[model samples]
Target: MSQVMKPSTAAQKLGILLSAAPEDFQQTPISREDLDALRENPPQWLQDLRRNGPFPRDVIAQKLGVSNSGLARGGLTDPLDADQIGELLANPPQWLEHERSVHRKVVAENERLKAERARQGN
Candidate 1:
């Protein structure tokens, strides 16, 4: 017997919106094997979604090079599609710039701390 997962869980694991998924996908639970197969050889719809997404918060944050909290602080509460993300990249707002700068500083600080710990044999 195949292990089954909820549609919402499948959507989360697949990194696509449940609402945007096909009716069959949204309505039906997926098997573990099927999910793995989807990952290994994605269908056109899956490819399209991954490529031109109203992506999840984490994906949006990654694309914008900022943290999820930064996104909220910057007033980006809605999901963004590929076009919107591209537009933002082309003409970044002041908030985006600020968030990016802050993210850079945070990353640098974390790296510095890691190096210090390594040197101290932590």
Candidate 2:
């Protein structure tokens, strides 16, 4: 024979269990003074440049070492300047995609190794 517990009683039991760990409790309060200071002295325009859209198309093309016409054909006409082009060349999107693909392959290999180890009881 089993008794059906009421929702309120079950909730109370759960609350008791959760409240038992006083040592595990922590508090993190944001300081109003710090927030006020941040509001007063905001970040510089150059520091927040990413808020602007992607660099100009010609700049991206230059960094990629291709002609502006070629880049325009590839649908990248954002109008980046010389400096932005240099930055883009140093950290190209295609390089990021390649790195991501490599990461996925490594993760898959690790998962396969883990499964094999589990099967072998190691």
Candidate 3:
């Protein structure tokens, strides 16, 4: 017998928002096999989500090249689609730009620290 899990668990495994999922999907408990099948051979809805997105906050942050905190500070708490992300990239808002800069600086600092640690052989 297949093991079943909560919708939220399935959504986490799928890297999607449970609320963003279809109503039926939100209501259903998914099996492990079902999750595997979805991963292995995604349906049209999953494909569309992966491609077009109303992506999760983490994905949004990654796409925007900023931290999750930056997104929050920029007042982008809601999920964002690919088109919306694209629009932001094309004509970034002041907050977005600032956040991107901050992200870049943070990344650079992390890289620098990593290199320093490597050089110290520790």
Candidate 4:
């Protein structure tokens, strides 16, 4: 049996949103030949995506200086290009700031709890 690639993997490799892709594109099992063709001679859309990414969540979060959970809380589900991430950094909306604040608070609380637990053990 030939190796089968998941759409999620393709999305990660292509830097395109899986939801944005056509159902056939997302659902099809790309054979090794098809995979090579996609890489060697990509469609215009794929080429555009390669040049300008619909970057993965981790990349976006790092660019935005926010945690992944903060990103989700800020309601940023769609993939973003560098420009978009830059825009958020330049002028963060209220929700983005709020989510970052919440993330900081959560981290502080976790640290405090950990210290308390250590103290109780002693």
Question: Of the candidates shown, which would achieve the greatest TM-score relative to the real structure?
Answer: 1
Task: Give the lowest summed-lDDT range of ten residues in model 3.
Answer: 12-21
| Backbone clash count for every predicted candidate, in the order shown | 0, 5, 0, 0
Candidate 3 colliding pairs: none
Overall lDDT per candidate, in order of appearance: 0.94, 0.45, 0.91, 0.78
TM match of model 1 to true structure: 0.89
Give every collision pair in model 2. 56-78, 56-79, 56-80, 57-78, 57-79
Query: Which predicted model would earn the best lDDT?
Result: 1
Q: How accurate is candidate 1 locally (lDDT)?
A: 0.94
Q: Residue by residue across 10-113, what tens digits does model 3's lDDT show?
A: 98788786778889889999999999999999999888888888889888899999999999999998899999999999999999999999999999999999
lDDT of 4 by residue, 4-96 (tens): 688778776766667666688888877676777888898887777655667778767766667898888888998898678778889999988
Candidates in descending lDDT order: 1, 3, 4, 2
State the lDDT at 17 in candidate 3: 69
For model 2, residues 1-122, the per-residue Cα lDDT tens digits are: 33444433332332222122122221222244433443466344322332342444433443465555556555564555446556656776774345445556766899999999999995
**Winner on lDDT (1 vs 3):** 1
The worst-scoring run of ten residues by lDDT in candidate 4 lies at 13-22
- lDDT for 52 (candidate 2): 40
Q: Tell me how candidate 4 scores on lDDT.
A: 0.78
